[model samples]
Target: MSTRLQSTNIPSIHVVIPGIESLKTSLESISHDTKFEHEKDMMFFRQRGKILIDAMFDYHPIHLMALFLNPRTRKMKQCTNSQRQSCLEYIKQEMIMFDAFDSDTQS
Candidate 1:
């Protein structure tokens, strides 16, 4: 007789929120998982850093606005909400651009 694994037993998908601690942990995990002599992974890491730096500069204004209107401040919820929306829109545009670049490379 064959047995089946239940979907509930499987791990659910999770979206990691971008934060300094989370980013550090993620980089450490990636480094640990990469085996020795993995030049490709090293190169990929460098490329990823470049992309991140580029995105940082591209989104600097949005990020500055978010920081300036941080939720931790008293009664800044509205500013925080606007900043969050701007961030989401910026990320969406970046994703679309990345997808287009990927398609062009694949072709």
Candidate 2:
């Protein structure tokens, strides 16, 4: 997944959102009850999941805007209308700022 993200030709954001989803799936798989596992180990993994998710969001909120634009993720049943709108609004404001900077540079 990291390799795909580093590729110059690929849609990097597409790989990113799903990569997290895959992580969540993997976390579930790893933390599930098994005959060989102890209860304390399961508790530790559960705690890790929260920390991981918090860190992911703390990295940057805007980089995640790319996820809202893509149709595949936009129309997902899991994606709410409000989430899309909020991210879109912030992204639009950012684009406007970039355009203003570009105009200043050109002039």
Candidate 3:
């Protein structure tokens, strides 16, 4: 995932949102099982997952916007309905602002 994220040709924002989502899903699956073979391994994954999930919260809106703008990722199926709606609202707001600016300049 990190290697793919670092690729020069790919848009990093496009990869980041989905990549983190995939990772979060995997982590949730791992944590779902009650039994753990190794306590240390469980602890390590829990801490790392917590950190990653928390970090994601801080940047989720920006990542969602990037995903929405990308042709391939525009559907953003991985995101929740509320999140998708939020992104749409933000884009609409930006478009309104741009239109206002354009009209003012024309005048």
Candidate 4:
């Protein structure tokens, strides 16, 4: 991860968002794991999974914006229409602030 960050000219939000979604999906799919020999261990695993999933959902706006900005993911094929709209609005707001900052700098 450090190597990739150093290699990129800018922060790679586009790449990070997809990788996060992939991990979240994988954890969501884990209904059962026979490798766990005891119920307590299984419970612990599920609890941790739930925490991670909640964290991912909490930061979903960041993920959504990254997806919307990425050319390859701009279509947001995996997202609902409402989510796409939310991202669009977020971007518009950011751009407005940026424009204002640019104008201020010119003075």
Better of 2 and 3 by TM-score: 3
The sequence of per-residue lDDT tens digits that candidate 3 reaches over residues 23-52 is 777765555565767866877877798687
Which candidate comes out best when scored by TM-score?
3
* Tens digit of per-residue lDDT, candidate 2, span 4-105: 778998677655656765666666565345566576777688669957874765323454576766776655333347656667788889999999999999
Indicate the worst ten consecutive residues by lDDT in candidate 1.
12-21
Better of 1 and 2 by TM-score: 2
Clashing pairs in 1: none
Supply candidate 2's per-residue lDDT for 10. Answer: 68
lDDT ranking, best first: 3, 4, 2, 1
Task: State the lDDT of candidate 4 residue by residue for 1-107, as single tens digits.
Answer: 44543566776765555565565566556446576668566667766986877666554577788878778878887677887898888889989999999999998
Cα TM-score of candidate 4: 0.57
Backbone clash tally (model 4): 0
Residue-wise C-alpha lDDT for candidate 1, range 1-107, written one tens digit per residue: 01111245542111112232244345445445445788677768866875675466333544434443445422323234665567567767877999999999999
As for lDDT, the candidate ahead, 1 or 4, is 4
Put the candidates in TM-score order, highest first: 3, 4, 2, 1
- Give the 10-residue window scoring lowest on summed lDDT in candidate 3: 27-36
Cα lDDT of all candidates, in order? 0.48, 0.66, 0.80, 0.71
Reference-based TM-score, model 1: 0.31
Candidate 1 ranges with C-alpha deviation above 4 Å: 1-79
Candidate 3 lDDT (Cα, 0 to 1): 0.80
